[model samples]
Target chain A: MPYIKIDVTREGVTREQKQKLIAGVTDLITEVLDKDPKLTHVVIQEIELDDWGYAGEQVSVLREKGITAKKQ
Target chain B: MPYIKIDVTREGVTREQKQKLIAGVTDLITEVLDKDPKLTHVVIQEIELDDWGYAGEQVSVLREKGITAKKQ
Candidate 1:
């Protein structure tokens, strides 16, 4: 099975949007990768702005550089 | 900060394969999405064949359909 994982910051996405994203992603994988939709697994997680860090800097600072943003 | 989570079955990928996958993915995100490699957080989780379910079917059976194969 082709195991796929997607990790995205949770700032811009809403509950409904997240659901749509998941379904769309599954469909995309099925269509392009030819994976079985029935056999594919999807997971979505919400993270706080303060908890994630990148490149020796916290996300809050990264946002100043236009490198990170809330999902919305 | 985009909290991206990836969950995949741990059948086909090796330690080196996993590391390469992670780096390749980070590069992909940076190049395609314009996200900073420093600010991005990557997570890789290994799931068992028995744990992942799709379309109401377990992955073990899904493999029989050729929908999924060990990563190789």
Candidate 2:
């Protein structure tokens, strides 16, 4: 019953990357939390820039102003 | 900060429904957990049937066998 939710910006993430993330997170939880992989659920959510907020401003607007995740 | 994630099958959820879910969940957390609505983040994830697993089988395969969520 280990449920993990990963939220990332919709920034052209590949299917392969998503698969790796799911597998890696599942393994990490199994090792650290002593959870069963079969009972673990890893959900990835790709949030739109406009929908994601930071410091009371939309990420889309921040990106337009040249403030990216890497800069932050 | 309070982060809430809601996962459901990718079954034609509308924008209005998503908005209602976000608002309702924020309000619920504020009331029950005493969390500030401004610090709350509600994410809605729509998962494909092929990606979701149940009873050691993918939901798509289970659906083909007529094992729906309602039945379980």
- Model 2, docking class: incorrect
**Candidate 2 lDDT by residue in tens digits, B1-72:** 899978898868999999999999999999999987999999987887655544334556667888777744
lDDT of 2: 0.78
lDDT of 2 by residue, A7-72 (tens): 789988766666667767877887888887778876666789999999999999999998878854
Best by DockQ: 1
Stretches of candidate 2 exceeding 4 Å from the true structure: B1-6, B11-45, B49-72
Per-residue C-alpha lDDT of model 1 across residues B1-72, encoded as one tens digit per residue: 444455667665567765665665565555444556765666778788778786788877787777654222
The parts of candidate 1 lying over 4 Å away from their true place are A2-72, B62-72
Cα-lDDT of candidate 1: 0.59
CAPRI-wise, candidate 1 is: incorrect
- Model 1 agreement with the true structure over A1-72: per-residue lDDT tens digits: 444556665466567765665665555445433455765666766565566666677666676677644222
